[model samples]
Target: MTQTDRTDTAERPDPPESSESVATGGAAQAQSQFRRAWTRFRRNKLALASFVVLVALIILAVIAPLIAPYGFEEPDYEHTLAGPGTAGHLLGTDLLGRDLLSRLIYSLRTSFLVGFGAELAALIVAVVIGLIAGYRGGRAEQFLMAITDVMFAFPTYLFAVLMVAVLGRSVGAVILAIAIASWVNMARLTRAQTMTLMQRDFVEAARAMGAPGVTIAVRYVLPNAVGPLLVAVSFGIPAAITAEAGLALLGLGVQPPTPSLGGMIQDGISYVTSYPNMLVWPAVMLAVVLLAFTWLGDGIRDAFDTTGTRR
Candidate 1:
């Protein structure tokens, strides 16, 4: 109504208080989302079973020395290649007289470490590249897609084998090889999700406000895209682990004295007629690990899917 009234209205603290309320609401929403996701995940019996199995394997791997009566690399000359139920060897003895049980436990640790590490590396690279490429579109998207196509054309196993051959047999080489081969899927998944998210109302609002490209992509796009990305990651770990084992079985993964499940299984091929425990334990371990990841991924997919059943 007057100059003083105009000044008073302009100086009112309502806007700041409103902004604070909005920020608080956003934080509450994020926490609620995480809680709902966890609740959904826990309700799935198969997923919970997988989580329990994963936790058990982790515990076994962590306490390998205590749980395993003998060292992974220790050789019992008198008990070499003993079948299951041998005097001291629980799972039996390998061709080298080493304890199969110990090796199996240690192999679990190595498999998980390599798988998780490789997947994480691939995931980081894929998410970053895919988000940027998809968000920017045009030439960047085309170029990235072209490169992804090229990668997809080559068989992953062949690429990994070649990389391992060049890099020599070692844990690091195996991890790098698998990561290189595996990242394409992650990249594609992230790109597709990012493209979809780019059209959402929040993103449009951010664009209207003249927010930076990076800010919009990171703040809005990535959060929405993480659901599928997590599913991809869950499956990726087992894939990497199996890949590593396969490579090692072919003598391109990890070298001897390293005690890898693949290496043990490969060696067991020679003693299958004499002692079956060597092959049995490794195969069982691999199966368990794969199953755990498979169930976990299914659980995660269900957790995020509105149409998915709770169990």
Candidate 2:
């Protein structure tokens, strides 16, 4: 206990924090980030309302069979062309004597399937191509980007129409056609995000540690890029829905016996001067779906933007 010894002991730094504490701190930080994003999203009143409506619409589509008053194609000979609030036919019957409400409900299901299915297919293609192009760069990047550029050169909707025509009109074909047309945007986005993230300190450290490229891309790069990716997906869903509807309108969508919003609109157009409800209901639903996704996408983009603040 000499004076020099006492001074040396007092000047020594505290021990490094435990691994458990570091893990806890990381978890806390992630939670805080999520909370902040959610708070920002909630501040957007229109977006919040749209999200609720979107969720309700999804639920309705899921349970359409249970809630719809009658089979989508069931003909009510006695109630042909019945108007709204007609006996047993809530929204009335179509030209074929089928219930409008049931067809609309089933049509919703078809639209959602196309939207989510197409987007998911596009996402898979985009992430794989984008990640490889960005992470590997050099010749790989050049080859992949060239293809993406070619896709970008085409008008997306027209390209989709051509693909649908070639592939024939079916739900699966429509989804594939839309995916082929739509994936270029997301691929470019993912590539940019991956390249930017690859330059980050953590990613560089992982590279220095001799981690495999796939491991680094999946473990570090992908997670960091998820926010922007989610925003992109939110926007893409509506685009997919719109494409499906347009195809259906043009008679190149899912074939007969499978109802779709666009098909309903097409059917209603001939009867527009007669029973307008046939045209109005499906059009209104389509408009609502488009608006809801657009608002939600904007909200998500704003929320994830660290530089922006929503008042």
Candidate 3:
């Protein structure tokens, strides 16, 4: 065939396409990606099981108030620290005869709140710093990176403790502390990704067309950078949760009356030698939740990675 015929054939639309068909095609592509990811994720049976356990734990947390026979705080001084499987006290009682299971459920809720809050804050800071640093590449980049470097220099727990000390010990303060220290890593990650995306053909084309800096950054750079950022966000949640737990362990987080996984674990520390189940069960749940998030992040990272397909 002549070159003209070949070009025309390549450009031709499919025969008799309707809006329904276009919608159907788009849905099919989405389903295909979903199925591919499911297939890959299921291949790791341990990860799949961990994800299921995490989901169940979250559901239990949401329904804890409804399910508990006794209130989390309604103390039964008459039956303090009753052994496991005691009358109406499922999973046993705390030092004050408060339901261990109920406390655990509430703790999960608080931990997740801290995790999500910190993750979102980190995402925003990272995107802004990364975009400006990557695109501008001069004084702004150096200054922001210098700040990020200072954050990175301290140990995670040490940074968190200092922030809480300065900011005082509210839930928001704890979350803010973790977010401030945590976001620098994400900023560096996003900045590296933005640098790569800025060099791509589409970015060059946008620049050639005289697109505004904000427009090009948002439209061209950000979309390309989103997958890695999402993966980072997923992984970052576990880190944030761990940070909150560490702060609570140090008696500087979540405060009284607001149960967090860390706080629950801290409450059990005194009784750990006597009733180790109190400490053991909470630690296990925290580990499982963190591992599930890490696995999910890994799966997402692998799914979005074109290099996997190339291999």
In each prediction, how many residue pairs overlap at the backbone (N, C-alpha, C within less than 3 A)? 0, 0, 0
Among all windows of 10 consecutive residues in model 3, the one with the lowest summed lDDT is 18-27
TM-score of each: 0.87, 0.90, 0.82
In candidate 3, list every pair of residues with a backbone clash.
Answer: none
lDDT per residue for candidate 3 within 168-280, as digits (tens), equals 88889988998988888889988998898777666666666667899878866776677678778878999899989888889898887777888888988998999876787
The prediction achieving the highest lDDT against the true structure is 2
Candidate 2 lDDT over 51-162, as tens digits, reads 9999999999999999998888899899899999897888999987899999999999999999999999999999999999999999999999999999999999999999
Ranking the candidates on TM-score from highest down gives 2, 1, 3
Q: Supply the global lDDT for candidate 3.
A: 0.81
Model 1 error, position 196 (Å): 1.1
In model 2, where do residues sit more than 4 Å from their true spots?
A: 1-32, 309-311
How well does candidate 2 match the true structure in TM-score terms?
0.90
Better of 1 and 2 by lDDT: 2
* TM-score preference between candidates 2 and 3, better one: 2
